[model samples]
Target chain A: EAGVAQSPRYKIIEKRQSVAFWCNPISGHATLYWYQQILGQGPKLLIQFQNNGVVDDSQLPKDRFSAERLKGVDSTLKIQPAKLEDSAVYLCASSLGASISGANVLTFGAGSRLTVL
Target chain B: TQLLEQSPQFLSIQEGENLTVYCNSSSVFSSLQWYRQEPGEGPVLLVTVVTGGEVKKLKRLTFQFGDARKDSSLHITAAQPGDTGLYLCAGDPAGNKLTFGGGTRVLVKP
Candidate 1:
């Protein structure tokens, strides 16, 4: 039972530069999520994918952030023209299902820490 | 726009001490989950309470869901160095997405 995998562990980019984070969820998981955790703060949901389709992304900043789960097994989150405020850890999580009866437990990744100068 | 508020943003205690953290929200939830995260790793689920007034225990840690289903609490007994970490609470209102609290950072000195 391997945990959710994410990379590259750390990243640094100048303001206005673009950066991308990748994630590979656990085997057989049907729901994937991307969360942003600023230092000293709780992780905030950026986007959620159920299989190959998006289930929720209302909190995502459409102007600068985007994410996709093409085949439903893996996902990528990208930020363009990054701002200093964007500096935070990007965490990836997966679950077996999203239904109330399905346990709804989330297994998270180590996360990718990004520094925007 | 549901929000979960966690109390005592930080806690520092010596080994053998006891402490408790609370998570509250005005919105009702179908279930709530507790997670503990280490410095460089992601959070791992400690427990989930689905029924109101439900109480679950994990070793020295105890979790309880409020009868109104809008609050939860975590209590640790005889804390140890191994218990130091960030404790977070998340609520599943609709079972589609989870709303998380800011988290409680616990430091247990040996």
Candidate 2:
């Protein structure tokens, strides 16, 4: 089976520039998540979508970070006017939404590494 | 507020050695999950512990959940180089959202 797919394995952009990362989740998965992971730290949830409807995005920096999972299959995370601190790996994951035990199993794709100058 | 804290931010040991990583939190969670992430990759789920005081073993790795449901640990026996990765513990506070710990980077030298 094909795992989650993310485009542009790596990207380099100057500060204040705009960049976007795309993710194709696993088939039949109803839940998708976008996470930001800084070097030497764990991934932090930036946004979550449940079948095209956003479930949570409280941690997302609305001023600069935005994400959308249109049609509930693929997702895109965009950072406008990227900041130097925005340089990090952006990870996309998906899961079957069910019970607590069932929902915690997340299948993640190789992340998109971004470097902002 | 970050709900999870992992101890020993980094670990480096030779093959065949044993090591343990701890995840502590004050907030009680319905379930806790452990993930292993390699450099340049996203985190991969290793185990999920729901019941308090539950213990699960996966080959050379063992995961234990605290009775209070606010803590967890990962233990590796006769660790191999293949076990080298960043270990992270995540707690589900609610609504399918996860709070991740700081992560512990493990390096098992061959």
Candidate 3:
């Protein structure tokens, strides 16, 4: 019954630098997601992965942001040449990947807080 | 992108007070979830309301979905210090994609 796990609980870097966050979802979970949470806003989905394939990534900043879930167990979210606006908490979550009509409650990680100077 | 809006961005109440937070959207969703988050942790799911006009209660907390399926509300009675946190509402537009509303930060002072 371990929850989702993420690395680097806090990160500080200068603008134009690249940063990456890692996540390990709960055991047996088949769906993973990456979200960006600003200072006073809710978590915004950046991308979603159903197994090894991506389900949705329309909100991701393609020019600077990229995510991969190799083998569908672990995930990595990267931002190149980060901007000041990119400073936010990066949260990772996982679910059972069941349909909306089914039971698929999400389990979230503590999140990695990024501070771009 | 579907937009979810939450009211009273911030609220502060004394212990034993009752408060309600709302989440609204113009677009319909298949399901909506409510979560509460502390300062340093990710959000924890509080409840999910799918059926329109459905009411679910968890202890002193009550969640209600609008008849139109585009809105939801969370009511807390006899709030305590442990109730202080950020409340977020997220709508599932599709099977796995979620759209979140700007959260409501509640502070219950003892």
Candidate 4:
């Protein structure tokens, strides 16, 4: 089966601009996640969705970063008025399920590299 | 928020050498996972340790979860050039929320 898929492998934009990234999770996966990773840091969760419903998004930068998984199979992330600090990689991941008993493994996409100049 | 700290931010070794990376957390987690990430790609799961004091092996890699469920370690035997990359450890709080460590970069030169 194909792994998670992401678009616009790379993006370059000036500060205060906007950018959007798309992701398609593995078939049948019910959980989706969006993460932000700095050059040398671990990925930080921005949002998570379970079958088209949001589960968690407390870490998201609500002011500029927004993500939605309309049908639970595909998702999109948008960053408006991108700040210089927003230059990083946006990663999409999916899992079959998640809960106390269902600690499923996650499959991640190649990610969208954003460069805010 | 749960936070994980990885030791030896970077490691450089020769082929056939052994190396160990540590991930520590102050909070308990229902499960823990280890991932290897190469340049220009997302991380790939190496192993997941669920039970406390559990040990799982994958090829030349060995993973151990602490008895306290707040720490884990990854050991690579006979490291090779192909093993050079970033190693990340993530802790799941049973809510499906994952907290990742700072990550350790390992470079094995042949």
Candidate 5:
């Protein structure tokens, strides 16, 4: 079975520049998520989409970060006027359903590494 | 905000040795998940414990959930170079959204 797919495995940009990462989740997965992972740290959720509708974006840095999932399939995360601290790996993940209870199995992409100098 | 804390941010050990990582949180969770992440890849699920005081073992790796459902631990027996990676514990207290710990990076030398 095909797993989550991400593009631009690596990205390098200067501070104040813009960058975007793309993610295509597994077929039939109803829940998709975007996470920011700093070096030597665990992944932090930037946004979550359930069938094209956002479920939670409480931790998203709205001023500079934005994400959207179209047709509940592929998703895109954008960072505008990026900052030096924005250097991190952007990871995309998908789960089979939108279960509100118990443990959900998530399949993640290889991730896109972003470097802001 | 819900927070999960992992201890001993990094660990280095020789092959055939044993090591344990801990994850703790003040809030209760319905379930907890453990993941292993390599240098360039996203994390892969190692195990999930739903019941309090639950213990699950997969080969040389064993996971235990605290009785209060607020903590978890992972122990590796006879570690190998292949075991080198970041170990993360996560929980979802507000339904579907998962909150992750800081992660423990383990280096098992051959």
Candidate 6:
């Protein structure tokens, strides 16, 4: 029972630069999510994918951020022309399914900390 | 959009003390979840309550769901330093998404 796996534990980039983060969810999981957690705040959902399709991404900044789950197993989130405000931890989570029942519990990765200068 | 509000943005107490955190929402939910997150790490699920008025306990931690399924609470008894972390509450107002509340940061000193 391995946990959700994320890569590049830490990243630093200058303003107006670009950065990308990758995630590989647990095997057999059908739902995957990307969240941004700023200091002293709760993690905010950036996008959600159910299999290979997107379920929700209304909160995501379309102008600078984009994410995709190719083949429904691995995901990548990218930010271009990064801003200082984008400095935060990017967390990846996965669940068996998107059900209203208590069975839909999420497991998260260690997260990638991005420091935008 | 549904919103969950958490109380006591931050708390600090001595070890062995008891503390409680609250999560409230105006909209009813089908299920609610509580998670604990440490520095530089992602959140980990602690408990999930689905039924109205349901109560679940995990070791020294107790979680209760409101009778109306609109609120939840987490109580820690005889807290230890290891309990220090940010506590988050999320609600499944819709089957498709889980809305999270601003977390409550707790620090237990030994």
- In the range A20-116, model 6's lDDT, one tens digit per residue, is 9999999999999999999998889999999999999999999999999999999999999899999999999999974556557889999999999
Among these predicted structures, which one has the highest lDDT? 5
Q: Model 6 - which docking category?
A: medium
TM-score per model over all chains: 0.97, 0.96, 0.96, 0.96, 0.97, 0.96
Residues B1-110, candidate 1: write the lDDT tens digits.
43999988999999999999999999998899999999989999999888899999999999999999999999999999999999999987775888789999999999
- Go through the candidates in order and give each one's C-alpha lDDT: 0.93, 0.92, 0.92, 0.92, 0.94, 0.93
lDDT string for model 3 (B64-107, tens) is: 99999999999999999999999999887656577789999999
Can you give the lDDT of residue A106 in candidate 5? Answer: 90
Question: Candidate 4 — which residues are off by over 4 angstroms?
Answer: A99-101
DockQ of each: 0.73, 0.74, 0.70, 0.71, 0.77, 0.71
State the lDDT of candidate 6 residue by residue for B1-110, as single tens digits: 32999988999999999999999999998889999999878999998899999999999999999999999999999999999999999977776677789999999998
Q: Second chain only: TM-score per model?
A: 0.96, 0.97, 0.96, 0.96, 0.97, 0.97
lDDT of 5 by residue, B30-81 (tens): 9999999999999999999999999999999999999999999999999999
Going through the candidates in order, what is the number of backbone clashes in each? 0, 0, 0, 0, 0, 0
Cα deviation of A36 in candidate 6 (Å)? Answer: 0.7
Task: Predict model 1's lDDT versus the native.
Answer: 0.93
C-alpha displacement of A5 in model 1, angstroms?
Answer: 0.7
Q: What range of 10 consecutive residues in model 5 chain B has the weakest lDDT sum? A: B1-10
In the predicted model 6, the residue pairs found to clash are none
TM-score of 6: 0.96
Fnat values, one per model, are 0.66, 0.73, 0.68, 0.64, 0.82, 0.66
lDDT of 2 by residue, A67-89 (tens): 99888899999999899999999
